[model samples]
Target chain A: MAVKAGGFKRRSGASSDIPSSSMADIAFLLLIFFMVTTVFRREKKREIDWVSAEATRKIDEKRKNILHLWIDNVGQVWINDQAIADEDIARVVRPIYAQNREIVIAVRGDRDVPYSKINTITKQLQAAGAVRVTFATRLEQRLQRPRR
Target chain B: MPILSRKQRVSDEIPTASMADIAFLLLVFFLTTTVFNEEKGLPIVLPEEKEEQEVSAKNILFLIVQPDGSVTVRRGESEQEQIVAYRQVEGILRQELAANENLIAAIKTDPSAAYRHMINVLDEVKKAGAERISLQMVGE
Candidate 1:
């Protein structure tokens, strides 16, 4: 008996063998997304004005307690409402400062106040045991137009 | 012949290779979404040093110089008044030193305040046993 050898045998498995490539692409995309989404926290320091060319590192805001001081254009040293003598600054600050060890004193001076007064006040705060100090200034307004 | 055909059929099967590509794509996607931080600014003037010196932590304090040239202690919303008198400050600071041996005082002055006024305040703080002194400018 001659076997039929000319007939074709149909393949039993499915025609498509390759898996979907979309899953890999999705994974890679997710990885890139995570990397781009991550944010680094920068150390926060109290803002102060420095006249020197060198810059200091930033400090954390949570650790700092700020003391606000205002200097008038006339060079008068007023602490809140009461006028204080030049010599009495440390004395007044010492007791108040002792209560809180972590304090950042912030100084806001008028543009016209003499530098000498500013120096004097800084010296006194140092004597009173203030560890941190910050300066406050308004950003220079951009010149709009030349005066007509 | 039959065994050879079976082997041929097995060899013709395709392998799945998309997982690696998916992983790489996910990694790239996450990397593109990250954000960075910006630095904040504070207007401060550091004191100049004639010689290289280390400031002791025990002698530093803080002073605030307002636009009006007035001085005060930074105590939260409620500020305390501390004027620029040498004798008065010296005495009070001395008491503070007695209580705490390690005290470093820092002074924050306003740029607008008279330079003379700042110097005077520094003189007083120094007189009170504050060895380590630093100056900072006020930022609005």
Candidate 2:
């Protein structure tokens, strides 16, 4: 007697045809996304020439409120174009500064101004109760250029 | 009467939702909308201290230093002039302290002025009973 034979076999699993290399592309995309989204803090600034020193240090940005004061090359002292006497500085500043709790006063002394003048002002500010005082300087400006 | 039997079959299917496109869109939106902060400066050399001290709110004062060796105090629209003298800064500072115990003073010195002028201002500020001092570098 001859037995009946099955003509075909049926497959029971799903096909795995998707490419694996696409994972790298997704990873790269995610990396680019994060890099684009990150935020950076801004640098605080003022325009002035400061005396240079060998050492430099970073100051905390949040703790201080800056006030700008200028001395021109021709020996003129100006607080925003208004000339003030050396003695009355405290009275002028007390009211405006009273609103802020912690303030940092920055001095931009002109190289041409007499050293004695700057010293006298610094002393006055200190006596008036300024907790922290800083002198502004430029590094490149401080470098002595040879006279031709 | 005859009853018929029903057979049930289960099928597996793949999902085709794309999240990468949405993520990319969001990233682009944030990149375009975000604002960057600008640098506000001239570099300043601050005085060093071993311990950090807190400045009282009521005691803070402002002093603007001009390119010339003059100091001024602001009192609203009007200004009081030339309060800083080499010898009398201490006395002036003491009087200010008498009015308010928590006196902190700020010095805004011009870039063109001499270093000695700043020192003098600092000396006067110290004499004036300012426990805390701050220096201003840029002019407004």
Candidate 3:
């Protein structure tokens, strides 16, 4: 009878200590959840030299509200990973602008792209009534000489 | 010899007491290493279609960007144009803006000019704190 009582007390005592064995399982579950829900940029990156500017600012708009318009040196315009014709810009942007009135167009043009190509895009954006625009550029810091 | 035998009698099962610690360490490592690529640019608002306003030429300060990356400054109501490098634009624009608070900085880029030239002039114009800015093609 004493042996039976001792066994019961040992079992109870073992359970009284929190089950830390499952801690790893819970941590793994959270890690898997984050890995599954993480959203990465889906668009294919285009190869083009980015222009740098001293006046570049971090766009304060939300991710969804901003649209990227990439103009390559060959004068190809890409939007949402689709190659778009210059003439059809207004047609493409109009419905999008209608759906979201707060959309901002970010022009990501290659440094060597002709200004004429950019002008055409701006005109198309105007016709579509998507007026708010941003010229995406790298931030340039002026190099100062070290004091002697 | 008996102690050696006793030492071998210890638990043969693998210890997992620090499994949680290892997992948590990995989690913290990934969390600290994840870098978000934030969007950045020079923001400008283009006028809506048919919303163009007619302002007097006296309030306009034209900065013409040629195909060779030369910037020419043409003030309002003055035929005299000043040729300057892109670096000198900020100072000239600052002086003009200070002289007239209502002055507008207009950027005219030639069709053949590289986009960087226009951006450089635009950067200078923005650096000078010009509120009213217009971007136009040279032929237009």
- Give every prediction's interface RMSD: 10.1, 9.5, 2.1
Task: Please list, in the order the candidates appear, how each scores on TM-score for chain B only.
Answer: 0.46, 0.49, 0.84
List model 2 lDDT by residue over B1-140, tens digit each: 43455555555653223445555566667677666432232333344333336565455565666656677654222444555543455566677778876666767667666665665566566445466566656443
Cα displacement (Å) at residue B88, model 1: 42
lDDT of prediction 1: 0.54
lDDT of each residue in A90-144, candidate 2, tens digit only? 6555654686646666666665566546655655555555545555543222257
Poorest 10 consecutive residues by lDDT, candidate 1 chain B: B36-45
Query: By lDDT, highest first, what's the ranking?
Result: 3, 2, 1
Q: What is residue A31's positional error in candidate 1, in angstroms?
A: 42
Rank by TM-score, descending?
3, 2, 1
DockQ of each: 0.15, 0.09, 0.49
For candidate 3 chain B, the 10 contiguous residues with the lowest summed lDDT are: B1-10
lDDT of 1 by residue, A1-148 (tens): 7645644565557857565656666666667667665654433332333221111224345432555565665555655455678778788778767987766665655644566676678778767766356544332222573422
lDDT against the true structure, each candidate = 0.54, 0.55, 0.90
lDDT value for candidate 2? Answer: 0.55
lDDT of 3 by residue, B6-69 (tens): 5445788778888788888878877776667678888899998888999999999999999999
Give the DockQ ranking, best first. 3, 1, 2
Candidate 1 CAPRI classification by DockQ: incorrect
**lDDT, candidate 1, at B69:** 48
